[model samples]
Target chain A: MQDRYVAYAIDITDPDDPRVDNFRNLTNADRRPDRPGGKGLVIGEGTIVVERMAGTRFSPTELLGVPRKLNELQAVLQDKNVPYFCASPEVMAKIVGFHLNRGVLAVSPRPAPLHYDSVLAGARTIAVLEGIGDHENLGALFRNAAALKVDGFLLGPRCSDPLYRRSVRVSMGHVLRIPYATIDDWGTALEALAKYDFHTVALTPQHPSDTLADTIAVPKVAFFLGAEGAGLSETALRAAHRRARIPMTPGVDSLNVATAGAIAFYERSRLTEQQAK
Target chain B: MQDRYVAYAIDITDPDDPRVDNFRNLTNADRRPDRPGGKGLVIGEGTIVVERMAGTRFSPTELLGVPRKLNELQAVLQDKNVPYFCASPEVMAKIVGFHLNRGVLAVSPRPAPLHYDSVLAGARTIAVLEGIGDHENLGALFRNAAALKVDGFLLGPRCSDPLYRRSVRVSMGHVLRIPYATIDDWGTALEALAKYDFHTVALTPQHPSDTLADTIAVPKVAFFLGAEGAGLSETALRAAHRRARIPMTPGVDSLNVATAGAIAFYERSRLTEQQAK
Candidate 1:
């Protein structure tokens, strides 16, 4: 039988300890994933995200939290020999440079990014994002992808790092759960998607186009979404096999990109479920 | 012919003028719509939101911006004769307490909150929210509502004020575009909703209930969503006429309540569109 007790579960009294250095000044520049020289470590806050991180490609190398969190993760920590740097709330806050309402944080090195071809290989319904600079929007999109059972994500140009700390926090850590890859070739990646039989549908409100529901029955599809205000580039939109609209009342501006993606993903999922039934 | 000239436009060089105090420290306590001493002013940032506010119930009482934004709104500003508190970018930033990237700001008092009965009356589909304290999510939901054509919004207990600055900013000013009201009596409001022949559809993943597509055909429906972490409270859930779920993968937490609402609203809109066809 495996030894149920964990030796690495050390109670830390000092916030200055080097053991939890990976978590220091978390909200500041040195830890900012998009910044140069930043480690871009995969951080999981709270038990749920930590538990989720445990099951993903990004494995936690260290855990920092209150003792209660250690108790909660005891079952998940049974096999790992990684250090659990448990501390008081004050100590943890001092180490992290802010009060963490989630009470625990797990830090992991980012795994290698997936190749565009590899991520697109099995995805039946994928979200292709362009210039989505907001970390929360990027994270929220990942959360939506995971919940709606979207196959994966494709990163377009000008998009922010999905593994950034704020993205990880806002996505409720679904950024760790979903697979994503950057598209360096921009519109050229449309050819790769087409080769895989994905109907590249550009989501835009520019002029009359097919409504989202009309695109549901298409066998396999990828919705290309641009940043909220300035949508897909003309080159990118031209690359798409088709264009679709969310069908709004005449005068309102388009929906936020993530919200639009959610509706698109939901439509695709509905079709798949209906087909299954 | 109307004598059209730029002479009516006054460009100011000062930031501390009392005329612009309504737009000062905007992201703070006194400007908060929910604060006790809060003036409950609805603020619009950027040319787009400013244009929207021009036609919304929250009429702009004061306008502050750079030359570019003032020029963009010149036609809309023609007849209003409102104070165009113009400034250079540097001065505008000092007044608003931040670098105004959107380049313009319009301040308006909150329109009277809609009557609970009035917003719901004659509505084919709407959304009811409870304990949704996150302003961004609330704002995103309104943006989604505008896109998906959800008729209006009904707020239950503990929901944050939708007119909060962050919500307005995150919603891209859709809060000004959509009509919404607070339901003070909690579950008793469900009875009033029923009187309007509305089916109160609780959006929860817990129940192995009807899928959203299956229920979208209901003539009059109100989709109820709760906060992100804790879903619909027992009272909110029990008060629902039916529980409908978006089909999602097992063990995954439900989609963000606002995203879920978008899907439900989109589903209803799609159904209505199909019937119209």
Candidate 2:
């Protein structure tokens, strides 16, 4: 019987080695093909994210790290045959164009895009994002969604690519684990959700008739969230079946969009638990 | 009667001018006298925070900004007698050690520290921090607390200074408006909260027998939260009247401490709204 996981360790001392080009200048946005302005590979940082990548459908084609990180990830890589380029901390930093304190990185080609229907197949709770252009917010939203049992995400128009490097890192590699799809046609997406019996709740700070807690007791919920300052566009808000608010103080500004989403997700989880009880 | 609000603009082109010294080297941690390690001034950046400072008890002794921001903030600074040290963007950037795109700043001497009793006075909901040493998290927690109507903050041992520049910026200047105090003795502080008829709930990911929603109905509630990775210490957990959790998925790590606190705060607000209805 052949071993299922095999890690080929290659030691490269040279910073300019062509073999390590995939890991070069990771901080440079222009180098990332996955970003809106650039064309580069998807990259994962640190041992934990690398381990997650190994388990996800988005398989890492290559890895670069120091010996310690390699040792830390040995168990995760045991069955999967992947090239692990091991280098000294100094050499690794020089090659990556930054001092990566995480000390390990995994690079994977973009996978085939998941369809909205495929991602929503069995999801009872879903998050819909519009114009969430900030990478950090996008990542944190994914992290919150996963922790709160939000089954999947559907990106509306103007949202940033979740596969962006910063988003991947901020999501703590959960972006690779949770399935997501882009909604090219907002109206069609809403129609599909409605057809699936989803209670489409638009989260807005302005003119919300219902509080988030009041809207969570449903069979299936799809929350529509927008960026912090310019909340859900009029078109997006009109498309939803209901409008819900998190219920905040009168004078204070709305909560951070990611935090607001987490609160909504938590409310949904709480309602579900109560129902079970 | 003379108008109480007046803006005194002093044009400063020289970065070395002594009048603008308080805003100099804004990014250098070593120069901050307000921090544990340094003796510097409390700084507020951008027009919104400056406006907040003008309204708060921590009165800005001096302010610096560009002409455009000065015009935008005229109403807020109209009654305050604080000197507005106007400067060109280039000079301001050179003095502050970076390009402050906000184009405005205000510096205030650390005001007399508020006693825990004073901060807790007339407060129905409050957040307590233990071992929350991160500036960004501390700031975000304050922002969430304010927006969610958590009236005050009580800092336990090992908590970072909420007035730090990064924290102030991250809080969108809410730290200035929200009153907080340091807990010299956790035991006494807990006793004080009890004396004031407040239910002290310690937020912990481990051994939490109750969910947050179950514990929010008391006349007053004080939520005790710890740092992200370490969570609430055993001593802190044992000190509280109850241990509560945010109810997350099984396999994922606990939510970010600030996010967890926001959820807890939101739950408290939700329960309060239900009671009112």
Candidate 3:
């Protein structure tokens, strides 16, 4: 008898196969993996991200890949009963509406988003993002957070969906691992943060703010970051307990949002790690 | 008789105008601004970068832009005698082989490369790269270096040119201002760094390495960095005065090369600035 996975593997010779429709024309805005029929659907590109999807709370419903990648992903797929739509690279390219060198894809339904309290509980250090609309920046921030040991993210208004395909891929699948929640209002979030005994500091370029180094000693900290241009809104800045700036050379534009967040996280990690020692 | 400035501004209705040939089909490998006919050509995109080019050593030989951008650049162009090839957006797009929303492009011949000693002089902190092939990352490093006040770059083997159009734009034109030089051999470059009283430190993810903060107190520091995956070459690592790492969470990949460099530069900047006080 053939193994169970042998039965689950379906050959997809035609790009138009309905069985693989979920992976089709991915560049289209409406059918984006992040949104299907107004609901969220997560897509992971490449073996690494697909493995991340398999390992996380979001188990992929199906997979599309060339034979090489499918074979490589055997260990990652052993625990799941998801169907593998094996296709040629050319057919895969046709379905995806562009050439994807990664050679593998995984699709999962986006789950209910986490709540602020759920994500904040027991977390010592967290990052709060405001108006970070760029998906790549959102993704990079999560990647940096994962590497620097930030516990979670609390997103304020105008933040883009972290489950978007580009975000997932750019985060190198770390977005799947780093828990985050969206806040309905900055005021409520700030109030909640205060109750948690967290020191909330806004990262901005404005002078008269304390340097990030001087503000990193608090036990529970949530560093707030904003988009590149039109930085944190006046409301977000005024509401925070403190404002801190990453000192830099004069005459240069501020660091990229993701880079700025990474620096803050690094500084926090360094000082806190040393304090523990 | 019209003013001399009016004569300098030439209107072009055709995409194939020979006068604007240097800006033609810029996306093509042969016509790429970074390497045209095997000689370096620096290109600045958008109004901001072109304005930067105007103020730097790389003055634009000619400019191609729409009426609005041309009018905006009048002050920048006042001192220069370069011809302005004004065209409609559609015509400009056709000539460039793509829709460039930047609305303006400037081309200038690359100046002779600087020497390692020249870029290394009077530098308290500097960043050195080995085998960094990504243009965007290279550009971002310069952007970060400029912001953090790193002196300049001493490029080892396999670094991509920062004068590429994409790098210039990604760097927000900071690449044009930041001085960099290529080296023939890593051994010779490290020797020169030693004589300059530079304490060379390799930033890697390797274990048993000193934390960046521990190594930040050196008088003249040169941080050596490499590409993301294949880090600094074994030879370069062994030759460095010290090996250091930015403390990161377990099992997570190291930060992006550019981000890592930024943190190193930031740490050096923070400590040095503190010491100065």
Candidate 4:
């Protein structure tokens, strides 16, 4: 299915058609992926995101877009056996329950969950997140991780579903490409990191502490990042090889969690460059 | 208004009461602080933001919040001639046109904007933004600037108002405290940077370019950050003392504008620490 060369544009004139049910009422939480009534169908929105989905395990089962967007994405659609459900902008709005400015979307079945080992394989740098419940933050972290060269994500606990529609959209579809796995017990995850020869650093806001500059030069490291308010749990903190702050101004609150992560990731690439020289 | 010890808890039972006009119909863009009918009032939401306003020039004309939130802020409110307009949650929601989970809001007339001279004076490591129109990015950049020790912002043409309601809220009210100036002409702004002995670096995604690590150590420096797609103009690039790229994984999109700024800010502090050592 990943190597086809034809575009099948199916015209969708009615909003209530069952064939296009996957794209309906996206704003409703229950109908969105991972929600109670939803079928755990992963969704990719916009032309760029739809193109990104072509490179991931979360293949687009079907695509919905206006004719113009479908025509633009014809090359990308060739690889998916994509049944492009073409609709006028008005029909698309009614089907989605809102006017999606991106004008294109794709739906996929949630792929089987990967284990920690699969995520840890060949990973030199990773983000082990604790209690990251906001979808935007979760998504932004994935995007930052992708750009800054973080190998993957090891989910600790209380993280929102990374493949949720909003997360996929916010991540610019990188969540589907960068691998992740949820290891329920923090202790077990720490053991796995150790087994994988990964040096672990827990990122915290507490200052007068060791800064990232003090500890980021190791060849293999996993930076553990926590949520905004309540930071890393005691188990997560105690298990880490070391704790480091991102070196912030005195008296100011910590940088946004995702921003802090970007700084950490950027530092890794930077220090790595310095080392190579 | 900056120095006082009084809290006038005015009870506002009716949402339509003209006395609390500043906080009413807040969802409508026209009624928002910087909009046409908004009178350019700088608004700070939540207790932390409202408290942060006390330290900035945007003095609160009055405050509207539920009794519980008002009581929580009583000690902080003592610093201002704060007329704490108290109302129930339902009444407050009706007044603001949404359910405010933070439950507190402060409104202040937008103070006269600072000029480049005032913002650039005594500054080191500032973010000179060009064409950043998103309020959230503007607000996040301010918050990042504050947390990461960026001294101020120099706004180029096409930038949005940092004093917008959403920007204020997103900055956690740091938008009110951090100084910024709109320097209309790019050439003049470049000359001013040079006049202040600032080594200007235009941040861009183009590779084989100098990295932030190459030039962040100068005593006085300003990083020119551009919008996401249409990055810094050729004129901005040519004017800089150097051009720096925040090192990233190739082929991945550049980091979000605000996140990139944070990395630059973090690099400054890290290098400064190294210099001290």
lDDT of 1 by residue, A121-201 (tens): 877889889999999889889988888888888888889888887888878878888888888667567777877898889
lDDT of 1 at A64: 91
lDDT of 4 at A17: 91
Scored on chain A only, each candidate's TM-score is: 0.94, 0.95, 0.95, 0.95
Clashes of 1: 0
Cα lDDT, model 2, residue B172:
90
Give each model's whole-structure lDDT.
0.83, 0.87, 0.86, 0.85
Q: Please give the lDDT score at residue A56 for candidate 1.
A: 84
In candidate 4 the C-alpha lDDT for residue A29 amounts to 69
Residue B242, model 4, lDDT: 90
Winner of 1 and 4 under lDDT: 4
Report the poorest 10 consecutive residues by lDDT, candidate 1 chain A.
A1-10
Compose the digit string of candidate 2's lDDT tens values, residues A1-277.
Answer: 6432258888989999999988888778775554476655789998878888987777788999887787788788887778889899999989988888998999888877888888788889999999999999999999999899899999988998888889999898999998999886698788778777888999998874698877779899999999999998999899888899988889788899999999999999989998998
Question: Candidate 3: misplaced stretches above 4 Å?
Answer: A1-7, A32-39, B1-7, B31-39
Could you give candidate 4's per-residue lDDT for residues A1-277 as a string of tens digits? 4422256778889899999998889887675445577788888999888888887898788988888887678777665566888898999999999998999999888888998899998988999999999999999999999999898999888888888889988898999999999887787888889889999998987643588877878989999999998888888887888889877777787777899899889888878888898
For DockQ, candidate 1 versus 3, the one ahead is 3
List, residue by residue over B1-277, the lDDT tens digit for candidate 4: 3322257888999989999888877767675454565677777899999888876797787999877776677667776776889899999999998999998999887777787889888997788999999999999999999988889999997898888889888898888888888887898788778788999988898855798878777898899999998898888888888989987888888789999988988888788878988
- Please tell me what DockQ candidate 4 reaches: 0.86
Residue A177 in model 4: lDDT: 95
lDDT of 1: 0.83
Ordered from best to worst DockQ, the candidate numbers read: 2, 3, 4, 1
